[model samples]
Target chain A: MDIFRRNNVTVAGNPQGPTVVLAHGFGCDQNMWRLTVPALADAYRLVLFDYVGCGRSDLTAFSEERYASLEGYARDVVEVCEALDLRDATFVGHSVSSMVGVLAAETAPERIGSLVMVAPSPRYVDDEGYHGGFSAQDIDELLASLDSNYLGWSAAMAPVIMGHPDRPELGEELKNSFCATDPDMARVFARTTFLSDTRDDLGRVKVPTLVLECVQDVIAPREVGAFVHQAIPGSSLVTLDTTGHCPHLSAPEATNEAIRDFLAGLPR
Target chain B: MIHTDQQPEPYESQNEGAPDIQSHRDSTPDAAFAALLEDSAEELYEAAPCGYLSTLMDGTIAKINATLLDWLGLERDAVLGRMRFADLLTVGGKLYHETHFAPLLRMQGDISGIAMELRCANGDRMPVLVSSVVKYGESGEPLLIRTTLFDARDRRAYEEELLRGRKAAEEARRQAEADRARLQDALTVLQKSLLPDTLPTIPGVETAAHYHIASPDRLGGDFYDVFPLDGERFAFFLGDVCGKGPQAAAVTSLTRYTLRAAALHDADPASALATLNTVLHDRYTGSGDPRYCTAIFGILTPGASPGRLTIQLASGGHPPAVVLRADGTAAFLPTPGGLLVGVLPDAHFATAETVLTPGDTLLLYTDGLTEARTGADRTSLYGDEALLAFAADHAGKSTVDVIGALTDLLASFGDGLDDDTALLALGVPPLTAQP
Candidate 1:
């Protein structure tokens, strides 16, 4: 199987420059970084791809036995790096993909130079001594919300609340687009994303890492970002004033600048 | 103009000289109508069935109806500019609002029928169903979120009852699964009891046996045993009962006990099978359910000459026993024209006599081996020809070697082996063993 075709890998920017891979979170595809890509495209070679079962990736390649955990997704990340012939790459991951980057960097440390985790939560469900910000019942409600509002919610509300007042077409394009995957696959992906616990894998990260916490993010709260930063050795934490789960989409300027500063400060 | 027309009494009071008609009374229609309109609008806003509110995009409360304030037990002044909608909910509800509700509203524009619990001024929780829509400005930018909430006391109570019922059902399902596993365990123990714990060793013969269970959940009806009948002689039997489960197990136990007793009594394989056939036919003849089996009974005796063993075998509708010679050749020991045992009052069983020389083996197996599917498509069976070829390929091997090859073959079948099978191989030691 062709790894690029399996993951729908797309390459842009400086061909000879060091690679910067942008991995999107759950409920979204590669297009989620549409707002932040242009900022880093000039100086860095960008590699963007959708996880299998998202975007234009081959859906037939999905196997239950192969993708039983986030490690399977990390394997896809490693394969994407190998397919693109990239080295010492910077991995920028959002939401669930943040933990995915951690796993991928651990898998092939030589391939990844640094990691930028935006609004990352290593776990979502609450534990004995930790507050992952959600109870089991809350996750159930979220799944039910997905069930009730699959495509209908997008058509009904896309124009009003999506931040792009100047370009409503962006919202319209997202209606049954972007994260428009098979509903069954989406449900499985959601389960795999939220039910995962990867806090133990953070210590294995050898690459320099950045933890970006948004001011009012409901998904990954301040404490979660702090916990991630404390877990990864020598990782820097940047708290953005952005007020939503999606910092790149809601506040692309601050998100891109923070990433830029971190990449520049790296010992290249 | 209507007020001026209806102001006859006031006009009369002003002009006291005018006529005072009986129907001409004083009236203040303008003031009364103005007061009524003002009272109704305020009343409707204060006491509507559903609560209504509008909040800024960041969730700070701007305007709220009196009905909502009353439900929360909070004064209008205290809630107006102070708290966001998410702040009013319980912790779990707050998390849900932030993760699912807020993101969904931002991307889609409206959310409805969401279940949440709002905190009251008294620190009590109130269950409510909420629906909200994002209002847009002329430029399509979000202006404010208009929301409607309904008191869901009855719905909550009903759902709680439903939840209790669902929990009970789930408990019942788990209990049923546990009970089923216990039954399967019991069945496995019962099935093991019918087979030999260990094959009894003869002075110069080696033996090995294997049983393949298609499923552990159900009891298989195959049985094999080797035991001493009398001095210098031993009896052995392997058979497949007609069906599975408790009834077939009963017949298998009865057949095994009867064969051992009959062989010990007469020292002949043919007589032993005859006794089993008679007992089974009599037991199930008048009963609605009839049990039957295909079986082979054998009696082995050390040869009066050296480097050999004498065997007398009887078959009742069973596959012919196979023999592998020391000279690297294999052939079937023919026991033809036999009928299935326990099916008839006088069913005839055939007897065959053979000798096992040094390094020769005699193998007996059930139909499951030959009938197992042999291909990925499951269209081809590991038929009698394949079994014969397998025996020929390992003709000069010992009992353990033959059983090992058969074990590999069975595993290679994988899910294709859909039936329970039993294999028994008895071999004489090589001639040079006693040197």
Candidate 2:
């Protein structure tokens, strides 16, 4: 169905500049990257796409079995790269999509040049030696929240965007607006995004990676960012003063500046 | 699908935080209050912290905990005196209470492990577990039936997870079984893929071959190859591989090919199977896995007399071929002292000359038939005595008739078939019928 599509809004900065792909987090399609996208377009050719089973993509293309593992979604990233035939593409993914980009970079290092992860988590569930913020019990509670009242939860959660809700920033309103889609996709996407565990492949990423951590995100807490930084070797981590899960949504100017600086410093 | 009966003003619905009602504080205070006030019946039987309820024989609200009343949105008036217990249950719950629960309780005085739903005061349905017991009066009369219900929200979530896991496990198992059967069927189809749809009838030599696979669950171990070698010389081989399933089937296919290819190198039946033995030994030796076969390979040369032939037989570990004599006596022909076809680096095969006179029969079979057992009496297997008796009755029978009857008899044995069976019977017409 047309429901599975991502309305990719392509923007070009300088004709000679390098290419960069932007990925939005859960509860949002590519449209949520609007504020950040305009700022990045001045220096780079920006490409963006929504994850399958989200946005306007074909929902029929989404499979419970195939997508049971988010690795398949990473594989989709590689295929999208191939379809575009883009060379040395730098990937910038937010929240869960950040982790997905990490996996995609690990899977196809030759195609992707570098990774800019916004509040990534290598694994959400705790392991023996590592604590990735949330416990298994906490995840269960989140799923219970979805089951209890999926619509009410989005309504309750939409107001929980980054920065002050009374005087919401542009990025916050963009995120709050992103949460206004049909709720069924929200539930399915939540299971796909929040419940994923991709820790085992973090060390395999050869590409240079940078994880932007929000100092106080209830979802994908700062501890999870530390875990990701530790798991992925030679990876630079910089903590964001902006609170909440979406730094790009709350502090787009700083978020865009951070991403631009990271990309500008990368190897030609 | 859900309705709430409480009509409190939306403004007064903020919650007072209790230790248990922490998350409930995010909703309305009245909701948190209802949680406590409605849980009375649930608190009764459902082990303190949770809600519990019980109903009488005539579906009356006989017992309840304080926790449930807080959940039901009722003040005891609407539920205690006026409503029946069935009224509290959802449509599916009421149906289960009448059919599976009630009848089981009446017959066994106890019914446990039932999942149902409770209709709350606001018409909201809650999942619950109901277990009941019937208490009999001292006068031997049916008394009140006691039913206990525990709020099953957490349990329902847990059960749904378990059901998903169980369904996934069952699906994996079922797929494995299906793949096993599909492989065997594919092997059988591949085996038939090699065979000509109909066998070429040798002039002056009447022939019939039947291959029986005891179980369809895996590939059969038995294999037979019959084809013309050269002018006036016809060849055939009946062999049994050492095991079952895909591995043995692979060996059977390889052995058939090796025999066919090696026969072109040497016309002797003994030499053909000798090459097959070397191939099997080399493929499986020292791998901690051993593969072997038992076989009886034969060659036939037609004679001047109508429907007469000279047959040379070379056997390896397989049972001796049965010769049904013209005079109505069946005895195993001596081709003993032969090694298993594919065990050692070098193995020897023994050849014996046997003549099937007019009205005679040659029955070549795998050991599966002779080892079959019926009931506890393992002695009553498809033994030598029974086969001899069967041969006497089938005197002067055609080759086709003999093989068909044996096939039907093998099927009748059912689970008695422990291994694969292949039977090939060739009968020569009586001299009196010859023109």
Candidate 3:
């Protein structure tokens, strides 16, 4: 299989610079990195891709069993890295993708060298004394929320959102469009994201890691950020002065600066 | 008359002098109507039928109309510049706002008619349809968001009803499919009970048989079986009962067992068929739903000479059996003037006799094969002549080889062959000299 085509992988920025793969979390696709892409494109080789069942990735390749867990998404990352034959490339992941990057790094240690987790949460549902900011019932509510919004994600609204008369250029740039996914596939990804617990895998991280959290994110609170930081040995944590879960989109400058500093500090 | 004329002149002079009274009467109502229209713009915004709110770029409520505040049961002091737009939504709606709604609005600049629920101050959920547009600054940067909410209580209730109806229909369809699958499995097991699992091997003869079903859901009416009558003689029968499904299958089961029992009593092929005919006619003739079958019963006996067998067969309105020779010759053992079994109290059965030496075979089959439609238009019958010619081509082959070739031919017919078919080939081993 052509992993690049299957994953809808796109390469940009300085061709000779060290590679950095940007992975979006659940809900949105690769377009989530639009603001951060411009910040790192000058000196870093950037790789962006939509996971299977999201964005322009081939929907036929999506298997419910294969993608029922986080490992299937990690396999996509590993395959993309192998397809590009990258070694020691940094992986920048947002939200649920942060844990996906960890799995991919462990599976193919040579492919991904360092990690940048943006608003990362190892688990969404709280357990024991750990505060993941949500309960099992809350995750069920999130799934219900996803179900209620299925009408908005339907094809009837696609043309209205894509063909904005004021922004005609958007139609050309976003061919498969943004944040639109098959509702069934989105449900699987939602269940996998909100129900998964990856905290046990945090202590296994061997790469240079940087965890960036929003100062006041409802999805990933400060306690979760500190937990991930302390779990991964020698990992640095930076709290961006942002209020939402997506600091890269909400506070692009701070997120990019923290990412760039982490990349520069890594061994050549 | 003179006095009335004088009064009219005086009244006319008074009316001409009072024109200002008419203008005063017209201007009074117009002034009152104008006063009602004054200072109503702010009142319209606060008292509009639908809720309206404006938020900063990050969803901070910068402004809200009294109509929306009334719906939310929140005061202006508590809402304005204090709570974000998400704070007013239920938990599910808040997640929806963060994941799909906000991202789509950011990319498209406007999103409309999204179904969502708002949590009122009293903890009651209100279903509402919301539309939002970003108010951009002069530099094309987003400055704030303008939103409108319409009550969708009636629409939501109707949609819920439709959802329930659709879910019920889907469940019914799933249950029907599962029931069909189970029924087919039961029919297959019952059908197997009416036929032999494997043909019994004769002392010096090679035997092969094949049965094809037209539909998996309906039980086929065709059955065939081979069993040893005694130590030296073997009895075999192939037949098709009229009609299909469970009733015909029951008759097929009865016909098979009757033939076996009759053969044990009297090994004559004609006598066994006569017994079956008697049983079927006695059992079904009294019922309104009468059942009948066309069958070929045959007996194989060791001949006086070694490596030779004597075959006697009787047909009851069945197609003639074919005989193939090692000399590349084939012909039908025609048993004409036979009547369909169970149709009358006494039915005439046509009997034919033949001897099978080394390198000779006998074939028995029902009409499903010869009656199969063929050709491009599917208007032509395969017929007995075609079967004779096909058997001639495989005259010198073993029973297994001939049956295997015929199976392929049946498969090639595809949909053109839409009836249950049974084929049985019994052949003798060809003589070979020592190498």
Q: Candidate 1 at B435: error in angstroms?
A: 16
**Roughly what TM-score does model 3 have, to 2 decimal places?**
0.85
- The C-alpha stretches of model 1 lying farther than 4 A from their native spots are A1-88, A91-239, A244-246, B1-49, B135-141, B160-193, B196-217, B226-234, B240-243, B257-266, B270-294, B302-309, B314-435
Candidate 3: give the clashing pairs.
Answer: none
Output the chain A TM-score of model 2. 0.82
Docking class of 2: incorrect
In candidate 2, which residue ranges exceed 4 Å CA deviation?
A1-268, B1-156, B162-184, B190-198, B355-358, B374-376, B380-389, B408-416, B430-435
lDDT of 3 by residue, A1-268 (tens): 9888789899999999999999998878888888889999999999999899887787778999989999999999999999999999999999999999999999999999999999899998888999988888877877766666555565554443334566565456442257777777889999998888999899999999999998877788899999999999999999898776788876788999999999999999
RMSD of each: 12.1, 21.3, 11.3
Q: Tell me candidate 2's fraction of native contacts, as a decimal between 0 and 1.
A: 0.00
Model 2 alpha-carbon miss at residue A6, Å: 51
Write candidate 1's Cα lDDT for A1-268 as tens digits: 8888788788988777678999988876787787678898888899999998776677778876566689988999999998876789999999999999999998898899899999999999999988898888777755654543343333333333223457655544443355455555666777788899999998888889999999887679899999999999999999998676888865678999999999898887
Clashes of 3: 0
Q: In terms of DockQ, which candidate is strongest?
A: 3
Error of 3 at A259 (Å): 3.2
Each model's DockQ?
0.12, 0.01, 0.38
lDDT per residue (tens digit) for residues B326-351 in model 3? 89899999899988888988889999
Deviation (Å) of B285 in candidate 3: 2.5
User: Could you give the candidate ranking by DockQ, starting with the highest?
Assistant: 3, 1, 2
My TM-score estimates for the predictions, one after another, are 0.61, 0.42, 0.85
